[model samples]
Target: MTIQIIVLATNEKADAVIKQGSLAQMPSLQDGWRFDFRKQLKALKHATAYILVREDSPEVIEGCLIFQLVDKMVPYMAFVEVAPHNKGDEKKHDHVAGCLIAYAFKQSLIRGSGRL
Candidate 1:
């Protein structure tokens, strides 16, 4: 399965991600999960969001990440999750979160943060 990682851009796209995230199940997020894309949209001064999706089927999101540029221009991972079908032992995909983190590192480089 070919997956493509992208930066979340619009509220319309964020809505789609919010829908998928609501259906996603991650152990790390089980305690009290909440991905406030609305808040992200409202406050993107130094933040960005990322998502991974099936290349051929854009609607099928595999993972997501939200991060911000903090002091010293560091990329601070704020929120992250993988789709329900792509979590745990019966996962449909692998290393999606890793890919997101790698992407964040790349962004940090692009933004002149040196390294992530």
Candidate 2:
């Protein structure tokens, strides 16, 4: 299935991300880094959330990422994860992580940060 990326800007969308089937399935603590998505997501002032949806099914989220616009010029991606089914060699989709990074780059440019 094709993937569509969108910036989450509403409570409805936020709720969807929280209720997604893979939400609880994802690691509560990031490996090697120890960041908490649940806690981090709550602090919206520090980061923006972006999600990837399966084109054929809006309810099916392929991935999600947390990024911050720092100094009003730098956009930093703090956390990212693909749906469990989309990880590893038998992954359901390709470049899910790359898509999020690209979106982050787009945000940086939009904020007048120029080329990264």
Candidate 3:
């Protein structure tokens, strides 16, 4: 029941897109989930399953996506986007963020499903 969480690099301000708290809070991401930042270059070496992306936008810190891979394949995932203080633009960004995550997951499944 081990889960690997991977964060992707974004084009925006690196510090803003990659939150230190999120990286630190990896241990709290659901039960049996492990967090590995890019700094830990060797973490991927032992990964049997992968959640290719977990991220939040700069506009809101509450959006997150958790993609799960079971038996070396993505079975399902959860995407959440929250608008802090009901900000309209932030809400839109949250939706886009969720959609982006879902699209990536779908693409990964399409690419990996046949191989497995």
lDDT of 2 by residue, 10-112 (tens): 2122212222223343334543224455667666454666667654465665667777776665778778777666665665565667776777676666664
Clashes of 3: 0
User: Ranking under lDDT, best-scoring first?
Assistant: 2, 1, 3
Identify the runs in model 3 with alpha carbons over 4 angstroms from their true place.
1-22, 25-62, 79-94, 97-101, 104-107
Query: Per-residue alpha-carbon lDDT of model 1 for 1-116, expressed as tens digits?
Result: 23334333321222122222222322233432355454553465566666666555666657777667776487676667676776656665565677777766666676646554
Q: Which scores better on TM-score, 1 or 3?
A: 1
Q: Residue 49: error of model 2 in Å?
A: 0.3
Sort by TM-score, top down from the best: 2, 1, 3
By lDDT, is 2 or 3 better? 2
Candidate 3, residues 58-87: lDDT per residue as tens digits? 333433334434455544443333323223
Worst 10 residues of 2 by lDDT: 10-19
Better of 1 and 3 by lDDT: 1
Worst 10 residues of 1 by lDDT: 11-20
